[model samples]
Target: MTQAQNPFNVVFVLFDNVTQLNFTGPAQFLCRMPGAKVHVAAASLDPVMTDVGFGIMPTVTFEDCPQSDLLCVPGGLGVAPALSDIQLIDFVGQQASDAQWITSVCTGAFILGQAGLLQGRRATTHWGFTSLLPMVGAVHEDARTVFDGNIVTAGGVTSGIDFALTIVAHLHGEDVARSLQLNFEYDPAPPFAGGTPATSPQHIVQAMQSRFYDDRAAEMEKALRG
Candidate 1:
């Protein structure tokens, strides 16, 4: 795509249980990426409620989502149904068939994997699910973010901002990304003791898995069966 002629069309696919921060983070960060244009695309026309209770009105449907230059799947509990929905999976699977750069935040990687796009690709997801990546045929990489081929996957939720910065660096230039990072004062401040499994105590991790991630885990397993 030519620079002047091509509008860098970006679509972030959202669904129920999607992490609001994943979309909001990158949307805010990359809103400044030169010619980058963004839209919220979803499986349905209805306003999809996120896991955190935020409602995102999708601007386009999968069938209607414009030919995207950059396509992102932002992770959440939505990844559960998205992986299982053949239509949604087929829609995203087509993205890999085409040449558009595909990216996912957190467990969105699981959706992409269900579409059979991540087979043998080096990808990363919410570090909590790192061990789970191999089951879907991804080469698990332990990183805050990982870039392999056309796929760029970010760790957990907040990392989506950094992932967008990286894309800005790749799409525009490193200077632009760095500038935005500085503009945002992109530094870490964690209110909690654990951001990742390694940082969280074993008991805490187990508690999280049992209490928080249990339903989502079951949903994923059901999707994998299909």
Candidate 2:
């Protein structure tokens, strides 16, 4: 298809146990871009649940997904299972081979790594899992949004909003992004000053680590090796 005639396709990889906001946040902005057509694709047509109480149904199946201009993966507790799905990994690898951009929010970067897409790429993930990047050949960078060529990885859940705005600014221009931000009223005046490990109390960080990510590194290593 001619460049002008071709639609800008943005495909989101949807699976069970995802953090819904990680997918929904970016998608809200991405779909607003000019000529952008958004899709949620999964291994099958079944409904998928989020780590939270809700569920979503995939609009497309991997077997029939169109080649996407941008491919996005979302992360949550579900990523561990996604990492073990060889079909999903191969599909991600195939899509990444030709996609203009491969992006992820939160632990979604791990999915990209499992797809063999992060080799030597500078990437980032949720703060707690950033260390796991090196195991999959990615150079870990601590930032809200990281761009290493065609790969853009966002840190944590809320960062997905920032990641989307960044992508839109780069692809569609700052004016478009700014206008969209205004439309969304994207100003943030967070109530607490302890969003990051550096800002949060050591005890709080430790408690979080102990609760959510104590064994994640080892688990990821095993998943990657398998």
Candidate 3:
């Protein structure tokens, strides 16, 4: 027989253009928690097109999202588009006001930053957004995961799995987290050995980065203005 260390209700907020891998990785870990429940929330109840063009049917809308013990925000290309929605930004900000833990993956930290939730909180996000995050009052931790008291932020998309395991440990104790980890048998072998800008070949990294933001650069300028 085992004991439940803590009981939790989790709310996962998804938006259009969100990266599916970013959401799915953490979700897989969260759903495995014993006696835990999750609510999938969106700006609207309608299906959202992910950054990769996959669609997800949201189970709840911001208007109807259940109050949660934990609020999770996921990041992707959608962030640039979603931040334009003041209500959604406000929703995440307010939700974190009462949540026991404010968690984010990848560029999801951008949402928390816009909501002003990450101010003074040590956090991390996708490598590309690291510099901008600190400008918003974050500590700019460069790690696969950063746990600053109640705020937990993970770097990049694949980092979601590591962050979730950390969360499970915090809530249910290391024993439970270890058990879950053993159950999942995670043995990842990423083909790309590079993670951060400093470690990767500068030429390849710069080229890849240029391709990503080539279009967004103008949009980013506009976003800053309006």
Candidate 4:
């Protein structure tokens, strides 16, 4: 077998206004792991809205969430509000305490930072929030995926796919990861080279910042300060 048949429990924290791809990408890979049980958990088993205007039904509640070998937290606009959510924060803290692998994607790293899990650790998040990591006691690294010990963090939305494969390789094997990559047809050849700020035109970057980052940074700053 490419992967060992050991039982594995993986839990993903679901919240309102989450970026669907952040969780979905990683989940797509993790769900295929042999003997792996994946759970989408929230404070309660209710439907949660996404930033992109869709709803997802959490499969389990925090109260019944099993001890996870891997715990994933995804990020979006909702993360600002969640900073003040003691229940959510507490749950993340508790889960991270025992999870063999603590991971996050995009702004999800901020949530983990607020949970006090990123203190003095090298981590990364969506490019927009790179500078903000220091406020939460994390040293930001600009990379697609950053792994420090048992804590792994991914860059913006799409990076979750790479992050998951990294974890899969860690737990399973390199062969298993390559097989899954092929199964998912993970090849990427974007029509445009504007995904990152460095490659994008200045006007495009400014436009995106004006539309999404400005207000988000302000609200997030306020939430973290409070």
Candidate 5:
């Protein structure tokens, strides 16, 4: 195929404790994009531990990875420490310098923000941490997926799927995106209509915030401040 026929050089930046789904969900779809070449990159070739008690092996090290056409960062409990990781942050900043699309899934947006990519951009992340986007100079958008120029940010976890499809549609066309949706049986029928804060019961939302995100967000804020 000619260069125009096969052009995407997609790269996913992996780190220890990353929420596996945040990367895997989007990878599942994006790997199928026409002419797409996906690269899983990290500091080394070691298996990166994930939040779900497993490890994802990296295909390339930061120094060896090719310049990305689409660069993605996925978030997890590891993000706080990752914020302080100078080498990792530098790698992200360097790849993004020439990437056609810059993106993050869930709290990974903060990583992008740390690299100075989200400044002045309209973005979004997991609803619980949307308020922290401002710390990175990002104007938070109230949506599952927010697109500003070539930067795309997705809400928590599964929202990466939507983000990927949106990118597919943008690059190829809605018809191609629709076909991939069908191929993957992308229809979502949840047992409950309560994914987001708005749709979820107020009590559950409060309890979750109290039990988890409240503290997590506090830590994220401190990390950003540093």
Candidate 6:
């Protein structure tokens, strides 16, 4: 179907304990894409629990989801267990077969990787797990968003917004994307200059890695191996 005539079916694969912002941030922007139809598909129609101590209701079951124009996976603490869910991995692989864009935010890249979609692709994810990309046959690209052909991977949670805006610009035009940015008042002025490892104080980065990411990365590595 022609772009003007086609409806953009954007599907987000949801799972229990997902980081809500990883999905919600992008969904908020992508939902505004002209003719966009957003579907939150999960293993069942039940509400999927998120890391924020709440749940997001799925709009459709995996069995009922439509062929997607864009397929996205969002990640959180649940990713380790999700890596072993055959049904979820299968759904991602199946949807990607026909999707115009296959994407992920944060450690959702691992889900894509588990589906064998990231093989030989340049990808990125949450900084903590970047080193593990090679385990899934993906080459790590140190960027907020990495596009390797039709596969787009975004780093961490908030980066999903940038990913969404980039996709909008690709499918629509700069004018439309720019308008969306303006509409959302997308200016970012963080209270601190420590968003990334390079920008953060050395002590802060070392502490975070030692206290959190070090173990988190090890857990992810174990999951990927399994």
lDDT, candidate 4, residue 9? 87
Could you give candidate 5's per-residue lDDT for residues 1-226 as a string of tens digits? 6455655899999999999999999999999998999999999999999998999999999999999999999999999999999999999999999999999999999999999999899999999999999999999899999999999999999999999999999999999999999999999999999999999999999999999999999999999888
The lowest-lDDT stretch of 10 consecutive residues in candidate 5 is 1-10
Please give, for residues 177-225, the per-residue lDDT of candidate 1 as tens digits.
9999999898877788778888889998899888878766766767777
TM-score list, all predictions:
0.90, 0.95, 0.90, 0.96, 0.97, 0.97
RMSD of 2: 1.9
Go through the candidates in order and give each one's C-alpha lDDT: 0.83, 0.92, 0.84, 0.93, 0.96, 0.96
Worst 10 residues of 3 by lDDT: 216-225
Clashes of 1: 0
Candidate 3 vs candidate 6, TM-score winner = 6
| Superposition TM-score, candidate 6 onto the true structure | 0.97
- TM-score for candidate 5: 0.97
The alpha-carbon lDDT assigned to residue 174 of candidate 6 equals 90
For 1-226, candidate 2 gives per-residue lDDT tens digits of 6466678999999888899999999999999998899989998898889989788898999999999999999998888878989888888999999999999999999999988889999999998888789888999988999999999999999999999999999988999999999999999999999999999999999998998687876676677777
Please state the error at residue 174 of candidate 2 in Å. Answer: 0.7
> Residue 41 of candidate 2: its Cα lDDT?
94
